[model samples]
Target: MLIQLAIIGLLFAVFPLALVLISKEQNKFRKLIAVTLFLTFDLIIFGAFTRLTDSGLGCPDWPGCYGEANPFQAHSEIKAAETLLPTGPVTVAKAWIEMIHRYLAMSVGVLIILQMGIAWWKRKSMRHSPWLPTILFVLVGIQGAFGKWTVTMKLQPIIVTIHLMLALTILGMLVWAWQREATQLVLKLPPLLPRLLPFAFVILVLQIALGGWVSTNYAALACHDYPLCNGEVVPQLDFEHAYTLWRELGRTGSGDFLPFSALITIHWVHRSFAWVVFALLASVAWLSRQQAETKQLGNAIFAVLLMQFMTGVATIYFSWPLAIAVLHNAGAALLVLILSVLNYRVRSSAVPVS
Candidate 1:
């Protein structure tokens, strides 16, 4: 089964590998990095879709569906499972979603391998260290491990949240690499701007973690109202259980049914934190506009910030439409990308290409 899975992964990965190998672009390395970055972005979105559709356990297995490489081969088993439990996790539609997500993940892994290979192959000619690709290679391996844990562990909130966090981290690392390869002169910013950006980045990271908590815990509609939670400005909440890090998906650490109050706590924290993140990011965007090189990025930050706020409220007001919820997740990722790129550009020294 594992060997067959390996072959399937290779087949999926081959298309991107061939594109990179046959490309006529002047800078093959940069082109490959860009393609990998784009694919990773798509993977993150698709992952959100998989989660939103409750397909995380579609196959109820890791790396393969019912011990088969593809859903088609496992259709009989899947149909039997769905027949026994019509509303359970292993429907034919969901099996396909889960398998497709795994295949894409495997393909991204192959691209990272190609990146590391090429980085080492041309190490001496390159201005950047090859270790960047080497590290990404390692991170992708760790991510694959978590993907398995997410399934085997039955989608525990902590594990799923960590998996999501790591994906964003991987995306940030890729953006950093892309900026390094496509170096352009960026104007110096005020000293305070440098310091403030990192602070804002930290805040954003925390907010994203909180957002993940809400999603993984199924707390999106806990409040289902704007400017208030459950129609109360200070809704009753169970913080002890709600914030417990190591518990099952819908149970407290003590194995009790997770209370509605706990879900309220989860939702409340995320919504409240958004205000702080939005304000700090707005300040950063405003300050960034003072410098010519960073002006466009500043605008991007503000635009994304607005989108996040609107979509966030829309999700609550509109009762969690799938598209808006997914976009909210994507907005968080775009926020990470823009901030990481801006930070990298600010710190990097641009040299004339002689």
Candidate 2:
């Protein structure tokens, strides 16, 4: 089964590999990086879909569906489980969703491995240090570990939230690595802009983590009102219960019923922090627009920020439609990518003059 899974992953990975190999780009290595980065973004989005659809437990096992490579091989078992609990997490459709997600994740891992291999093989010719890809390989390995735990641990909110954050972090790191390898870095901003970027990045990441926590905890509709949670500015909350670091999906740390207040706390914190993150990022965006090189990027950031705010509100107003919620996650990922680029451009040395 393991060997079959590996073969399947390799087959999925080969398309991108073939593209890199055949591309006419002067720097095929960079093209490979771009391709890998694009796929990682897609992986993150699909992961959000898997979580939102409650397919995280569709297989109820790690690395395979009921110990088989594809859902078809495990069809009987999946069907049996579905029959036992028709509305539970193991329906055939969900099993496929979960298994397909795994396949994509495995494919991304394979691509990262190839990335590390190529970086080392061409170290002398590569502009950037090979260590970046090496670190990314290690991070991807860690991500796989988290992926396993996300299932084995039964979608425990902390584990799941960390898994989501780590994926975004890896995506950001890849963006940085890509930026480092660029042939020419045209974007330039004032010194203060770069200095402010890291702080904004940190804020954005924390906000994303909180957003993940809200989703993992199923707290999206806890309050059910936009700008005012539970029809009150400061609804009753149970932060101690909600913020407990080690607990199951819906229980408090002490295994008591996680109170409605706790859900309110989770929803409220995420909503409140969104404003802070938006303000910080918007400030960064305004500064970015002042400089010629960063204006476009700043504009991109502003656009995504607005979309994020809109989707966030839409999720609440529309009572958490799956598409809007998924788009909200995509918006978060997009924000991370844009901020990562801004951060990279600010920190890296000027693009070499042509």
Candidate 3:
């Protein structure tokens, strides 16, 4: 089943590989890295849609939908589940969604393989370090492991969240690669801005984890509206249950209700953290706009932040609409990717060449 799924998945690699194959450009390697990053970004977006829609376990199996490569063979099983519970997590449509996500992931894995191959092939002749692509290959392997764990564990929140983080990490790495490709120096140091950029990156990562936690726990609707949650600015919370890391998928450690306050706490904390995240990122973006090398990047970060802020509100006020929620996740990934580029460029460009 895994082999078949991988074969089916390789279809996605055709276009990008084709571009590298027939391009008239002298430096196909750099273009290949950039294009791979672009496609991987799209995959991360679609993966968000899959998880948000509760399609992670649509197939109820790994590498295949009910021992079949495509959802068609598993139609009977899917129909059985849908008939049993019409709107439950497992259904025909969801099966398709999950399978598509897997297919895209496999395609990306193939591309990464090709990238590493080419990188090693031209190791001595290449201007940039070969370890760049080599490291990407390792990251993709770790990502695949988490992907399997996500399904096998039945979409456990921590596992799923880890998978999400891995995807974003891969995006960060690829963006770094693209920056290296954009310039001749892979080891170039970037300018430091008040020593606050890296500090912001750490905080942003925590915020992202909190947001993912909120999503995985289905706590987004706990507060329902901005500035107030359950009609209180800071309602009574059950942080004990909310922060219990080793609990089951939806229940407390003892298999009880998990506490309503836990949900509120989860939602409220993420909401509060948003204020900090927004203010800090906005500052970083503004400061970046003053520099020539990072100005455009800062502008791009601001644009993504706008999209992030708007989509977040739309998700809440509009009742977690699929399009808006998916866009929110994509915006988060883009924000992370941009910050990574900024971090690398800021450090790389600022280094003194002696």
Top TM-score model: 2
Query: lDDT per residue, candidate 2, 265-337, as tens digits?
Result: 9999999988989899999999889777778989999999999999999999899999999999999999999
Which lDDT values do the candidates have, in the order given? 0.90, 0.90, 0.84
For each candidate, give its TM-score against the true structure.
0.96, 0.97, 0.93
Stretches of candidate 2 off by over 4 Å are 186-188, 350-354
Whole-structure CA lDDT of model 3: 0.84
lDDT of 3 by residue, 175-277 (tens): 8887776663333223445477889899989989998999888887887888777688889989889988666678887788778889889889988988899
Ordered by TM-score, highest first, the candidates read 2, 1, 3
**Candidate 1 per-residue lDDT over residues 319-352, each given as its tens digit:** 9999999999999999999999988877675221
Off by over 4 Å in 3: 184-194, 351-354
